[model samples]
Target: MNYVLYAVPFFFLLIGLELLADRWRKVSTYRLADAINSLSAGVLSTTVGLLTKVVGLLTYTFAWQHWGVFELSAQNLWVWLFAFVFYDFCYYWNHRLGHERNVLWAAHSVHHQSEEYNLSTALRQTSTGWIFGWVFYLPMALVGVPPLVFLTVAALNLLYQFWVHTRHIPKLGWFEWVFISPSNHRVHHAQNAVYMDRNYGGVFIVWDRLFGTFQEELDEEPVVFGVTTPLASWNPLWANLQFYVVLWRDAVLAESWWDKLRIWFMRTGWRPADVAAKYPQSKADLSQFVKFHVPLRPAQQLYAGLQFVLYVAAGSFLLATGANQSVAVLLGSCAWMAFGLYVLGLWLENRPQALGLEVLRLLLNAPALWLAEQAGLLPISTLGWSLLGLYSLASALALVLVARRGSAALPA
Candidate 1:
């Protein structure tokens, strides 16, 4: 089943409901725009993922075909299932290590950069996760999981994660111990000392429970979200690049080359003494103002929740459909989607210039999509029509959004 395409609408529907529920219960603590921006990153990233998968598939088929793993995978579904489960187990380590190591943290920090925690946070994924990120999944290949099942299970695992990002859910009794609940996951997103680098789990919290990385949410000191060095700006590209840029600057600033080299691989919080001394550590307590600024009204809360569900449903559909799609087509579509939404979200949040750019992109994409269909870049199917319609609607909404701002400042 092309589960992802269906998941996209499902995601929007649920997110909309979640938003409305927040308004009713008054539990939300994030802005609608920020949440939407985060989700836009998510939609863009999921679309970007199509390219990575295409590259991965080609490398697996033509290049790695002679390997023993493919042979083993050809015969055994059980092997595929085991590999799928084991891969997630390994993911827990990769995730845990991402928080613990500075180099990995630089890449992983994109997901955590969102100050707001909501369904969109699940969508606030990293575009460059293919770097070193693929390494964690290799064990599945080694153990003979066919590329197809590996991707399907991987997508399913990711799809499972969508609902976990919400703040509307409380701790789920014993489920909290065995699963990644909103409360526990919120602690993982926290930059607070007690919560930092803890609760590394994907579908199952059992890994965190067994690994000693798990930390229960504290009522005494509420979870203060975001990184120690807060990303104050709203630019998506800046969010992605900030840690790398910081790492490079610190490398240059270090008096000794060893300190420069040492810092990037060290624990995430580690900084050279001089850097620490000059910059000082930031421990902004978000708890005080969180209640005042973030909670949503019942209707708006549901609307946001529904919006998220819709993006996920759309993203997942494309992801699953593109899994088997030709590499060239997948890559081309992703190039448009990732860069488009990434910039659009930025325009919506930080800069107005991108609004014009997004307009150009929207204009170009419609004809490009039609041409792609004519050129057989994509199959003309019901699913394709649905995607085209939704994307068109989304793009139109994006343009209207520019006008809605009432900035009246055209591109300079």
Candidate 2:
């Protein structure tokens, strides 16, 4: 069973409740664009995972079948318990190394790009983590944890980490010592000098306490969320690729062949001496930090939000049905979703060409839906097609009205 898929509605419900809590506390933690961008990255991650997950599953299955010393039964309660703890143990190192190494951090940085600490920020995940993430859990497979048990515990471990992303939760007295709480996790997300690479556990705080990476949230030094190199754009695609792009450029520019190869696996933030001298990178001052933002009119914000709702609906359908789809269908669906999201990011940035791209997207959607139906990838009734038509028309009309009202002026 796909627990993450089933938990989708509940996640949104908690996000809504968090919003209410923010209101009650008289604090503003959710920004429309930032929240939407965070969720968009999440949706993209899940959508891309649908296509890439086979790599991890197949690798795990191969390892277990080939090298298992014991055949663990899922029915055993103790097996489940052990797997849960062991998964967190593996996750601690995976997460710690992700922050410590340059290439690993390239894929992991998406989660920290959000300046706001909220439920939505929790969903900001990497689409490319599968490239190296599977290696972390091989110990579980070697120890003969059943695949089903391993998957269930992995999902539960992830779900447990979601609630810790909020700012509303205060530090628990004793619980903070053993388990990850919002306060400690906030330190993990902070860019402050004291908090930069600390608190790398997912569910258990003991890992950090034992490994010497733990840092307490200090009253004198409040946590400032986001990376040292601010992701200045709201683009979800760019968010995932920004660090990789930086590394790629550095690798290309490095004069020494050894530095070119080592630049990727070297310590996080390490640059070749030659590249550093030629193309200096500036670090933000933690004491005087400012968030990256692009101004948008109210109408533009509303339009972007409404369009995101439709994307969510489409993404939910894909997640629920993707397992049963053929490779072609899954890839096609992912590509379409990714394009739509990229276009949405452009719209949020108020790009001059966004309106034209949106029109193209709407026009292309009719054929895309029709093709999916014909390919038997999606079930489309007459009403479904009618609704699609109506939605496209409505969105186009909204774009026109927003543009004519001079609210969505193209960025100069």
Which predicted model would earn the best lDDT? Answer: 2
State the lDDT of candidate 1 residue by residue for 262-332, as single tens digits: 99889987888887888776666555433213333343334334434544554666676665667777766
Model 2: runs farther than 4 Å from truth? 407-412
Q: What value does the lDDT take at residue 13 in candidate 2? A: 99
Instruction: Give each model a TM-score.
Output: 0.76, 0.98
RMSD of each: 5.6, 1.6
Alpha carbon lDDT of each predicted model: 0.71, 0.93
Task: Name the top TM-score candidate.
Answer: 2
Give the lowest summed-lDDT range of ten residues in model 2.
403-412
Q: Give a tens-digit lDDT track for model 2, residues 176-221.
A: 9999999999999999988989999999999999999999999998
Steric collisions counted per model: 25, 0
